[model samples]
Target chain A: MQSENLISPGFADPVFQSQAAFRALLTALSEPGLIQQVAPGFAAPEGLEPATAIALLTLADYETPIWLPAALRDGPAGAWLRFHCGAALVEEPAQASFAVIDGAAEAPLLADFNPGTDQFPDRSTTVLVQCAGLAGGDIVTLSGPGIAGSRDIAPIGLRPGFWAEFSANAELYPLGVDLILSQGEAVLGLPRSTQIVEVR
Target chain B: MTIHQSIPGEDTKPAYNYAYLDEQTKRMIRRALLKAVAVPGYQVPFGSREMPLARGWGTGGIQITAAIIGPDDKLKVIDQGADDTTNAVSIRRFFERTADATTTEMTEDATIIQTRHRIPEAPLTSGQIMVYQVPQPEPLRKLEPRELETRKMHAWAEYGLMQVKLYENIARFGEVTTTYDYPVSVNGRYVMAPSPIPKFDNPKMHMSPSLQLFGAGREKRIYAVPPHTSVRSLDFEDHPFRIQSWAEPCGLCGAKDSYLDEVVTDDQGGRMFVCSDSHYCETRREQGHRGTMLADASASGLVEAKS
Candidate 1:
């Protein structure tokens, strides 16, 4: 195995950049929707990409069960996550609080997972969706709990079908999964409560 | 100055637990807890430090229990309020090793209760503090991404966005459909996340005598609501805050008012409503509140009941 194949590998060595990524995730979640640059580490598996690795490093713990895409389930990614984060592999999406949907086109139906109950929306699963490109481009009107006014930044190569599935998810409101779209080294947040309206 | 060394080889006891989080971490958690008691339904952010346990686990609750625990204190931990649940058992075991605190399944006997999902069925007294393990601390983060912007919104008391979201829910669902973790406005100040406890537990926060503390170790934030403080669930007058209700009482203890967990009994889809708080239900049964069939079963000596 390559030296970089480890999820966090030696990044937990208390280096400047690894601490920076950890702090970035902490701040992003604390503030919400706020983008913080993370110096990416770990060699991502074929379909399960670099951004997914970043998220796996930041959030995965022994207590959290990770739901993997079928293709990546028994692959190097599974071994890497287990060895590095000690995360359990969950068979069902609903049982997993954190899910890695590599090649999200093949990802399972979002409704099948826990969107959380009405009073406890945070219990809903947070999915890390891997995409081919994830750069901010065109504007999409976004209004919900987090937006002061509508704002837009297009994540790259995310299928229009993804948006449709997400909007269907929005119909559930307090009971919808939150999303993390990652392309290459970039990641963007799409909490379930966010209302995304296509401008174009 | 002469360099000092141990006179002979001896096993040294580490001052703090594995993560350098000492009893003082629990003490600091306890102090925050007391302040939360003094004010009700308020999000009082504390300087939450990292724990050896992972962030999502009951780090916040553990810290609080550690701080408030003395030699005499009895602790209880529940995930979904079941004492025997795996996570609950693990948390109780953690305290037994670290703090050496006596553990209890009963809510009445517990000085500190750390919970996820459900609060205890029995109402807690002023003497107890409930520590909630929070995954996210910012209520406005869902509204605004920038901390700088959200802080301003909070300072200005701008909760119009939250209201708009709820209004939309009503508009869409024809009902205010939020069933659990409904957002709440605390002390007429901050719109706070009540740590994902069901809406059934929301009303329990209103001017309650017991203190409530929320901790998010992963998020590195702490907030509190002291006893006797005002906590209003975020809802319009037209769409008032409501708790989940069921026509039936608990299967085990005949508890009428307690939050119930729906269990699927058969493959054909028979469901049963059991008390979410096993300890509270057991206590109630001991005090004699048996369901129609249950009381008869007990009377007939068909089943033995344990409190």
Candidate 2:
């Protein structure tokens, strides 16, 4: 894992930068469909968005197992993650605490990852997907605990039938994966508790 | 580039990291917090760190505050609804020094509130985060002593034992005798312990605009109730859950709705009930809201002057 291939430093001021990023992530998750900007000043490798990289750097640790698709695994992304975050790379998607899905990669079935048990629903995976853009795509309205009434978001670059799969995943209630969709420097969250409806 | 260092006048070097806990620990706790919010009321296990404060004395809430607090936040700390108490003062000062954030006693001005044993009488608005200090995060701890058994029960949504316990209380006392630390079901799914707050404040947990987070350091657990979440106190149809009420208003602020603290005035069994929330009382008094005690004192003073 020590093989050097131009790995970037974690953060200029690790504490302040990570704290800011964490707060943004919290806001994004707390208010589902809310997009928050994350400018951590870390240079992300190719094929990985800066927001996704910032989220991983702020949330993942050695104890957290990260799953990367073949595209992300073969590139410099895996090494970069291992170098900076010290997160373990898991082979199986279901075993991962966090998983990264690139825009070009096929979206894995939500059931492939852990939805956690009834007792410990928080043990479910947090999926970070790289999107082409956060705005001007298929519009979906979200309503849930954090939302006041409803929030509309349209994330681009997702494969067809993503919402259908998400609808099924949301049915899990207390047991489902939480998603963070990143495009460039913006990230939007869609927690399991959120009720999503296509604006067709 | 050294960002933090001890000055010449300082006795001991300020060696502690910003907000006390290191960045790694904060990240770990932050991840747990996100999950806790995602699944409201579910207790998510985290690596709780040791703070300067003792275990039971709000170490859990301190850790959560430390993880989330930044330079921009306005913090408020309260113990039993009073901002001037020992625990509240110490916690407030701690954040002021470490996080360098502004501290306020007023509930309306605070962005983040860390409280033990009580919720503020004033309603919390949207965007504010309430952190509750919890000694015991498990709602079924008393009923089922075994941790493994209780975890299984929670997994299966087995709350029959809790219902039975409440039923027995009703059968014995003709009403539910339990008052503080009332158990509530979060989002109609996970039954949660809403800290040691009096039953009177339990209604504030339902559909509240502010996000509520609970931390139990000794138990190494963190849980949350997101904004607009449903929190229902456990009760039966025959005897619905009721809050504590008093015939007498606050002796200091003339507030009939706020929770009162019974103060012993003399050894001759004289007592006066005052508002537990000192800030609320002070604010009301400033607005010319006088209680019975104040009225009596002013009247006696006028009588002495005339004589």
Candidate 3:
């Protein structure tokens, strides 16, 4: 299907791909820190991964503004998203309702994104980051509400320098940004509520 | 005005993003959904915005659906499950036009089912998720209107008030007057409103394989029943949980094990019983449950003539 023409009339009727995306998101959100696959046959943005694009499509709306990393900010990818999804591009990360980082390596530390205010922790930003791998490796011990005691998740790629930043971010408690790390088709969640520690 | 004046093109610029929500709104909803799922029947308070649709008309279901829908998935929207009824048609048509996902009438075929007033009679599988449109999310809202008070009540595990209300209902009507949206406690912690589905559908919510999500747009809350979660209707042991019973079969499907919709057919109030789950009814009919009209027609060999 032609890229421009494909989305215009909306996905050919009856399957309801958007609704499926919505349900996947709820399941992902419900079981926080769990990996859920995005619907098949969805077109991923040039630099953005499928998981990131799926999250964007399901949650992004007219009222929210999106911030794209410098790499994909000015191109056909940007125009295509604007034309189809109607998300606005914001210069600052704090102003962005949703921020898409092509790769977590370049993604700003947890503190750079909005952690929200004392009264309303839910006002925080949700960062969708792209990763090279999603599973299988040294496990990070995570403890939180959804987790039984300490659940092991595949270690996420991050700069060693960012540890101090995240440690400080964790201190903020109720006010912090949530994250979704995507690798091609696979998507894993890391809501702010989760306490993460690297286990040797 | 010429056709060009009305049509929106690349030059005109379409309003709204790919999924109709901006990122910030998506994050807000995502956070609420997480809390809803985490608490497991606790009504999470959210700042619900007005959708393009009306307040009471499936906005809660629509918001929850919007928060969860991804780009590559199938969606089914049903109001009583006909898929052609005015509201169902409008909602299915809404997602079809905006989100551009595939829509279907079949329950087994859909991955996400956004429903109102009823749940499908067919048992849902683990693969499927049900989003219910809730007018109110709090089971205690009618009993107590204040949010601060309810939070305190939940914190203290205080449900005596809800039990007392049910007890009063027993005293007044000799049975619970609540025919639909009957309150139920989840995992001994939170009391939740099971959308507005009639009491017959309440049992279906208990320990079902499918995940159940409830959203109230006007009230701005979200809640859920995870796969195989214990959900109990608030009642005395002697009172017991009961499903609405009818002596007659569905007028259209001739099925007995489904929720029946009461219909008034005559000035004398003669009634016709029919399946409230329109899709289930249609499926049974397709499988050959011929009701009064079809049965009479078939018995006379009029089916061939009609065809």
Candidate 4:
């Protein structure tokens, strides 16, 4: 890890900033497909987006194992994460409590990560993926506990079969990866319990 | 990002960290909270911290409020549906001093409500969050004393023992005798204890717009039911789950729908039922919904003035 990469400060007032960011994260997860803005002024390395960086800083700690994809692993993003959050960096995706996917196109299958067990389903992974935009891609309809009736989202940059993979992930019920899709300052959550269907 | 050295009125009590719990502890709990929301009804273990209050005195709910609340949130605390009770008032004041957040007794005015043993009669909206103080997070604790075995049972979705216990209740009494702390299935997946709220309030948890979070301090567990989640109280098909009802309306508020607490006025078995939610009762009274007790008091006062 390079020393210059660690120059970026964490939260200036760690207590308040992290608290606000965490609350935003909680609201995003609780209301699936709801896009939220977090830590507006916090800057990250070249590869990492602001929403992704804020999510990591708010949720990850020493107990959490963060897995970085090849691009982030070799870049300044890894060092910035290590310097700010102090979370363990895992080489394998299956062992990660949190995983960062730089781009939605390069994202791995949902099954590649831990789905946790029936009793301890919360042991699964939470993946943060950078997307091109929160809106203007293939329209996805989400219906689940968080949604009152149904919600329509158009997330860009995902590959062709992303919804199929996500549907398969949803079939796991209580055990599956929770996703946070980020683009610049905006982020949207897609918990495993949500049923996603791509509109024709 | 300027940090304050001391807030005004710091001399009243010992200086505490923002929201009482430190940043590291808050982060740990926040991670667990996300997982808890992801897997609705599943208990996620975390490092439960010691608070100024004792374990059974709502330490779990306090830690949760401290973790999620900021300076902008308006908080409400309730004990047995009353905001003026000692436990509720103390917890409300604690947050006011530590988090520097606004406090309210009105249900509709609050963004976050930390409750012990009851949900408010008023319906919760989409943006509100409810934190429940749970003495025991596990619904299967009475059936299985060992934590390891209970965890395995939850993992396997083996709720046969719980069903059997309910069956035994049916055998002893004609219907399910258990009233408070009724067990419910969240999203049809995991069996959860809806805190200690009366079964009358159990249905309110079903498909609620507001997010619901449960915390058990001694048990070191946190669980959640996100907005619009399904929560069904466990019961048989033949005998459906039912809420408690009183033959008489509230003596102070004239409300027939609210949960009532019977108050003894005289030793000769004379008693009056009043609304347990003091705020609700007061609001109704202000709206000119007078109960029998209020009517009687006014009548007596009029006679005294005439005399």
Largest DockQ belongs to which candidate? 4
TM-score of 1: 0.54
Candidate 4: tens digits of C-alpha lDDT, residues B38-139: 889999998999888789999988999989998778999999999999999999988877778899999999999999999999989989999999999999
DockQ per candidate, 2 decimals: 0.01, 0.63, 0.15, 0.72
lDDT scores in order: 0.66, 0.88, 0.70, 0.88
TM-score of 2: 0.93
In terms of TM-score, how similar is model 4 to the real structure? 0.95
Per-residue lDDT of candidate 4, residues A70-129 (tens digit): 778777888778888888889889999999875455457778898888767888999897
**Candidate 1 lDDT by residue in tens digits, B36-131:** 332223344555777667778877666655544544567888999799998899888877765556889888888778888778878888557677
Q: Which prediction has more favorable DockQ, 1 or 4?
A: 4
Q: Residues B1-307, candidate 3, lDDT per residue (tens digit)?
A: 0011222365565545434554456556765776455456766677788788899998888877766665555787778645678888888877766566588888888888999878888888876889899988877878899977876776566889999999999999898888889988875557888988888888887777687888888888877776656678888889997878889889888888888878898899787888888888889888988777345656587776545
Ranking by DockQ: 4, 2, 3, 1
- Per-prediction TM-score, please? 0.54, 0.93, 0.66, 0.95
Chain A TM-scores, per candidate, are 0.81, 0.94, 0.85, 0.94
Please state the error at residue A178 of candidate 3 in Å.
9.1
Question: Candidate 2 clashing pairs?
Answer: none
How many steric overlaps are in each model, in order?
Answer: 23, 0, 30, 1
Tens-digit per-residue lDDT, B1-307, candidate 2: 1143333467476666778888788888999999999988889999988788889999999999999988778999999999999999999988776777699988999989999988998999988999999999999999999988988888878999999999999999999998999999988888999999999999998989898999999999999998888899999999999999998999988999999999999999999999998889999998989998876545666555433
Per-candidate alpha-carbon RMSD to the true structure: 19.4, 3.3, 8.2, 2.7
lDDT of 1 by residue, A18-109 (tens): 32344344323322244556675556665566767766755566756889877677877887778866789888999987887753364587
